[model samples]
Target: MTAKEPSVFRQGFKDGLPIGIGYFSVAFSFGIAAVSSGISWWQAVLISFTNLTSSGQFAGIGLIASFASYIEMALTEFVINMRYTLMGISLSQKLSPAFKMPFKLTLGHCNTDEIFAVAMSRQGEVSPAYMGGLSILPYVGWTGGTLAGAVLGNILPFSLSQALGIMIYGMFMAIIIPAARRERPVLFVVLTSVIISCIIYFVPAFSFITSGFSIIICAVAASALAAWLHPVEGEVADET
Candidate 1:
């Protein structure tokens, strides 16, 4: 409402563009992966529309590829995506009292690490609209990229496609490298997750799903334990 406040909202909009661009490349890869694995282009689009998460979508693709049962796919995604629950809780404290309900309800749907970091960095009576406004463009870009990639997958050269696929993971590493440097808890979570994942690969019964639920399980468990030990610091006003 204040002149100063609109500036923050505008900043969110501007920042969201680059963030959206980053996700588009990754989501585009998911689209190609889905289509190559036998899912139709429309189906790939729908998947991106319904689930914006890279992990969840990738897990679903694996389940679809292996012809896994619905129960298996649902359970895999549920356990992995449990991190969003914690993300929503943290974002709630940042919202203005009046905007709390709306933000709590909708933003949870779009709560990936990038957007979560954007929301958490704010300092005052942050508006939920700012969060929603920023997130929408990227969500569209991701979904659109997926559809485009699925349609274009076969037309591209094999080697080039392979390179592009690897690039997305490199982008992920770039995202991780920064946070892993400063956040001991995040570093621990990622490292522990990787170790557990290796165990899952080598172990028999635990290897039920290759959609990579190991990292999800480790992250949720580790983050839950961390949150319990170091309860999230509440809004600054609570301190005053």
Candidate 2:
């Protein structure tokens, strides 16, 4: 291994540190939410460790709590996490030729939005050692925060635990509000999703739709409408 490779790995690790810190706070809220939804603390931690997806995991726990069907859960997760497939494809272009399939598969599992953005911003092809270093701390932070929050949820007052769970929603809003303000298409899609979700939640006729299915429908319908209305005309510019 070249000495330069170790330096590159260290740089990646340093770049990922802040992301790891941010993930801890968000994952804490998820942990609380998961446990409050009637799952055991260990189960919540296990989900966080394996899934590494905030929105999908939260939705999955909600489905589990409501006794939703397996198919519903599977489809809901698939729809919500479909973006990751695109992200993986994009990141593949940035990978060094020496980054083998096994390492690529491992890195793909933890390729969250922040991690992907950081990696893509780099000047050249990403090496396996760099990707490995980039992934480690965030993975640890997410799982460790889940364990902490899950244990605390079991001990904290029910009211306090519930309040902590609201943090996750606030985090989502913080992410959406900025993007929606910057892009008209994003705002339109957000509004469409919200309207459809509310209709599914409040209308008596739509009560047959399970929470998982409702999420899938809202996301797909909103995204489809947005894409149809504002289709990209050419190769999309990299925002990174």
Candidate 3:
């Protein structure tokens, strides 16, 4: 509302543009996966619109397809998305003091990994106007792409629909690789997490564990290890 606030908002929008573009393809993949897994197109859109979390939504769709119990779905969603709580806490510190509880609630609803990263990369306190701007485009891209992809999933060739499912993983790699390349600690954490995940996935002993639990174990173990080996000063951080 201040005269200078518009510029902050504009900068946030500019920063979030790439994330919005990236979300389209990833959400496209989710839409395909959701529909292929037997959900209706509009249902898939509703999931994306309400949740806006890639891992959480994918896990929910899987559980839904399997006809898992409500408790099962609830646990999976909590384990997969508990990291968002930390992300919200971290981003909260970076916000300008004027960003009150109401603004925090609004901004927190749409805080994804990329949005958090973009907001943190800035040098100063993040503004509420800026956070609002940052959330807009990605929200549109995610909801819009899900709707589009769900419609397309109905008509696309089976082979093509299957192929599109991998785009979400590609988007994840795009986010991780650059940071891994720049930081040894990050690279170590990623590799450790992957190795642990593979073990839990393939080993007979852990085969009994559900996918959600496996992810929770691998993530927490690798992150704890990383924190022990390479801690960041002035903040407690965990890799999700």
Candidate 1, 112-158: lDDT as tens digits: 77777666655565576677677876798789889878987667677
lDDT of 3: 0.82
What candidate 1 gets wrong by more than 4 Å, as runs, is 2-5, 122-126, 166-213, 220-240
Evaluate candidate 3 by giving its C-alpha RMSD to the native, one decimal.
Answer: 3.8
Put down candidate 2 lDDT per residue, 1-240, tens digits, no spaces.
567898988988998787677677678878888888999999999998899888899889999999999998888898777767767877987778778889877877888877877787677677888888888888888898888888865575767656655654664575678878988998999999999999999999999886656776887799889989998444343322
Question: All models: lDDT?
Answer: 0.73, 0.81, 0.82
- Model 3, position 153: C-alpha lDDT score: 58
How do the residues 1-240 of candidate 3 rate in per-residue lDDT, one tens digit apiece? 489899989888887777787788788878888999999999999999999888899889989999999998888888777777766777877878788989877787888878887777666778898989888889998988888888875676778767756665665687779889988998998999899989988899888876656766776788889989898866433221
lDDT of 1: 0.73
Off by over 4 Å in 3: 1-4, 36-38, 154-164, 235-240
Least accurate stretch of 10 residues (summed lDDT) in model 2? 231-240
- Worst 10-residue lDDT window for candidate 1 reads 231-240
- Looking at model 3, report the run of 10 residues with the lowest lDDT sum: 231-240
Question: How does model 3 score by TM-score?
Answer: 0.79
Model 1 — TM-score against the truth?
A: 0.74
